[model samples]
Target: MIEILNPTLLTRAAGTGALVADILHTLKGRSTAGTNLLDIDRWAKAMITEAGALSCYVDYAPSFGRGPFGHYICTAVNDAVLHGRPRDYALADGDLLTLDLAVSKGGVAADAAVSFLVGDGEHPESVAMINATERALAAGIAAAKPGARIGDLSHAIGTVLSEAGYAVNTQFGGHGIGSTMHQDPHVANTGRPGRGYELRPGLLLALEPWVMADTAELVTDADGWTLRSATGCRTAHSEHTIAITADGADILTLPKHMRP
Candidate 1:
């Protein structure tokens, strides 16, 4: 489904985006060396409850996953990239961690993710990969405007990753998000420009740009959720929920303190 928030509903969506961004910001701050993945999930759950919002992940049971996600946040560490189910593991210094969260408030949903090194990891390759994803995400957002095609966003994102020496994976990418969570207009990380759905005012899209260092192939962990690089190469992901407007694309999922 392609959801276009009406003026009144868009107001509610703005709140949902703020909540998602706030929770992600808080969780990122708390994640560090020796931090348990479960603890991060707990922190997110508490914050969501305190805000009177609902978690889009807690009961997310898509056919691709084992069962209901049962977690408040996705903690993808190092090799792990997508659908990372929280487990009994403590983060160590130099570990690359990705925190993805989605929440609904006032009947609207927002999703976002960030990847960063746990402690001070000065590995050049790792740092480069992280930076590339962030750059790609920015490019995608820049291409998302009224009358823009999904392919334009995809092409913009792909250019960054490809130029940075990383391989793009298309198995899972961004999607339309609204009141119920995932929606239509699948946004791939790489594609031809001037194609796919045309952007329109009031449309909400979650543009995520993720890349694996060496291979585009991925292997699902035994857990049936966590996706890891086939070559165990490092990975990074960056995402944001944006809404189309007459003015341009408004990035709704920016943290309150970081808003423009």
Candidate 2:
């Protein structure tokens, strides 16, 4: 379902977005060499509970996944990209980690993700991949505004990834988010401009740009949730929840310190 949040709900959305961003920021700081993925999930649970919010993932049961997620957050490392279920493995130096989080508070939900290298690893390729996704996400956000079409944002994102020499995967991409986690108006990573749904004020969209180093194909791990690159090449993902307004798109998931 597509939801155009009212002014009151939009205010609540900003709060939820801040919580999501803060949780991710804290998790990224805590994740290092020898840190267990399960620990990250536990941390997420505690923070969410403390904030009096609900996790959109714990009870998330979709056709693609094995069952209810049963996890607080998604921890993707190295080759893994989307729907990464937290496991018992400890991270190593130079490991690329992606933390995706979604939460609801005051009856509104927000979602975001960030990919970064663990420890003081000098992996240039991983850094480049992460930068590319971040740049692509910015491009998508720049294209979002009242009267702008969804394809415009997708095209902007795809242009950045293609230019970075990374293959784009369409199996999973950004989507509308509001009271619930995933909503309608599926936003693909790549599409033609001037096509698809037109943007409007009060519309909330989670724009994510993810890419694999070599191929666009993906292989699901034995856990039946984590999606990894077919070639085992490193990957990166960047995302943010944006609200369309009269002036432009307002990024709701930016951390408190990063907000204007």
Candidate 3:
């Protein structure tokens, strides 16, 4: 379903978005060498509960996944990318970690993700991949505005990834998000400009740009949730929840201090 949030709902969305961003920022700070993935999940749960918010992922059961997600957040490390289910594993130095989070508060939901290296390990390739995704995400956000087509954002995102020499994977990409976590219209990572759904004020979209180092193919882990690169190459993902407005696209998922 596509939801055009009203003014009040948009205010609530900003609150939820800030919470999601703050939680991610805290988690990223806590994640380091020897940190267990399950601990990160626990931290997320505590923060969400303290904020009186609901986790969109815990009860998320879709055809693609094994069952209810049963987790507070997604912890993707190294080769793992999307739908990364927290497991019993300690992170190592230089491990690329991607934390994707979605939460609802005051009847509105916001989603975002960030990929960064853990500890003091210099992995140039991993650093480059993370930077590329961040740049692509910025490009996608820049292309979003009232009257802009979804394809414009996708094309902008794809252009960055392609120029960075990374293969684009469309199997899973950004989507409309509002009261619920995932909604329509589906925003692919790559598409032709001037095509697809046209943007309008009050529309909320989660624009994510992710890429694997070598190939576009993905393999599901035995856990039936975590998606990894087929070539086991490092990957990165960046995302933000944006609200379409008269002036332009307002990024809802930036930290409170970072917001204007």
What is residue 100's positional error in candidate 1, in angstroms? 0.3
- Please count the clashing residue pairs in each candidate, in the order shown: 0, 0, 0
TM-score of each: 0.98, 0.99, 0.99
Which lDDT value does model 2 have at 63? 95
**Candidate 2, after superposition: displacement of residue 105 in Å?**
0.7
Report the Cα lDDT for candidate 3: 0.95
Candidate 2 ranges beyond 4 A from true positions = none
- Local accuracy of candidate 2 as per-residue lDDT tens digits, 107-191: 9999999999999979999999999999999999999998899999999999999999988888899999998999989999999
Candidate 3, 1-260: lDDT as tens digits: 89998999999998999999999999999999999999999999999999999999999999999999999999999999999999999999989999999999999999999999999999999989999999999999999988999999999999999999998999999999998899999999999999999999999999999999999999999988999999999899999999999978999999767878
What TM-score, to 2 decimals, does candidate 2 have? 0.99
Q: Deviation in angstroms for 44 in model 2?
A: 0.4
Q: Candidate 3, residue 1: CA error in Å?
A: 1.6
**Residue pairs of candidate 2 with colliding backbone atoms:** none
**Candidate 1 per-residue lDDT over residues 97-170, each given as its tens digit:** 99999999898999999999888867788888989999999999988899999999999999999998887889
Residue 154 Cα positional deviation in candidate 1, in Å, after optimal superposition: 0.6
